[model samples]
Target: MARATTAHQLHDLGLAAWFGGTLANAVALNKAAAHSGDAASTGAVANEGWDRWTPVNAAAIGAHLIGSVGLLKHDLGRMSVQKGVGSMALAKTAVTIGALGVTAYSRVLGRKVSQHHAVPAADGTTPTASTPPDVAAAQKKLKQLQWAVPALTGAIVAIASYASEQYRPEEVHRGMLQRVLP
Candidate 1:
């Protein structure tokens, strides 16, 4: 019986950090920023926090990728024999790619908002009473993507859970036998 390795720990921990951080930022940090009253200050505070978290998030993502590769290398034989493993792996990969895309897009939108220092009107002037239509549009997009980051990461966590369940000794033996027999 092979015990789990450091790679698996890294993979799980890194993913947890990535998922939890994204959710925390969306639920808490963003709300706090919005509560600050001044729209420009809200953008500044949120942008600053995200900027500070960027390096840590990058490290977490890198660790998860590295760990995923290591785990895949170690489990290639099991994965080949397991009936559902390949499909689950593929799904996880797709979700990961989507999450990465959403993260990047959110950052781009955040940068645009931060650069303007306030939500600009459609005509490119700052609004006094309400959010400018252009800025509102960007914010709307960013809001969607921001929520998406956590949702995608949460899906990955669920996928990982399924993979873990599939790694049980009985499940592994059954999978291998199914492959050998059929």
Candidate 2:
């Protein structure tokens, strides 16, 4: 019970951080960096912000993965017997994989932009007229990917909520009955 509780806490905390931080950055940080007075300063500001967040985000992802493994281990028997648990687990796993892939790709793009910190930029993911072609291309892709990361994470959160509801005592009883009767 303690192990399960810890795993649940870690999973929820890590996921919340990952989702909130990315969304905050996309919604405010990226755009706000442009207010630093110049295109070059904008790039520098955005680079610094994202660079600072990298390690923390990595830790959050690590925690989330560890917790996911712990929770899966704890829930294996429940999943085997419960009607909807296996499907929920499969769906959540798929979403987690998608979120991770998007996050990794976005980080790669971020690095491409950050490496050229002195380069001119309209904002974090927006390129200026004088921005180099390569960095500009990366920024263009990141502009799209920024939203994707959060959206997928948000989907994970939503799915996890649904899965939690499935664990209610009544839900479990009904699901088990359905499994046995049908």
Candidate 3:
């Protein structure tokens, strides 16, 4: 029979999954918007993406709440061995770093693209200083994405590390399986 899981274990697992899924969705949407250069789409995506965090963060907080209540209850259950938590954490770190780098690249691209484009001011005169509203809006979202993606990626690492430690203590325990299997 499996040992009982500490409340902390469940919380980490839930948060890791939530953060990972959220980051993936945001990154995918941002990529699509970047490709299409659609301001409405980008802005809408940004709005939805950013808004998702309100509830998600709340859920994570709720996990903490549940964890705190663990004192009132007996053991819930032992966390299963999550095979890929360590790999997932490492992968997440790489992705996050890449996302940050992409942010810089995106900003440079936006500036260059804006230089070739023009936007109409309130007077309807095209401003040489900026791109059109649609283009500008899209760029603005990209700018936000540049920072957001990497930040989210980092969160994935943090979440993964927390989850992995609880589910896979083997690396710390240094199981005899390492000796036998090798």
TM-score of 3: 0.36
In candidate 1, stretches whose alpha carbon ends up further than 4 angstroms from where it belongs are 1-4, 117-134
Model 3 weakest lDDT span, ten residues long: 119-128
Candidate 3, pairs of clashing residues: none
* Tens-digit lDDT track of model 1 for 9-87: 8788889888988888888876677655666666667667777777888888888887787777777777788777888
- lDDT, candidate 2, 72-180, per-residue tens: 9988998878899999999999999999999999999899888987779999999999999999999999999999988999999998899889879999998889889
* Candidates sorted by lDDT, best first: 2, 1, 3
Work out candidate 1's RMSD over C-alphas: 4.0
Instruction: Candidate 1: give the clashing pairs.
Output: none
TM-score of every candidate relative to the true structure:
0.84, 0.98, 0.36
lDDT score for residue 159 of model 2: 89
**Which sections of candidate 2 miss by over 4 Å?**
none
Tens digits of lDDT, candidate 3, 1-182 = 11125565654554464456546554564455333344434434434544455466446546634643451143222212233334554564465456545544544544443343322221111111334555555555554554564475466557545544644556534433443354
Residue 56 Cα positional deviation in candidate 2, in Å, after optimal superposition: 0.7
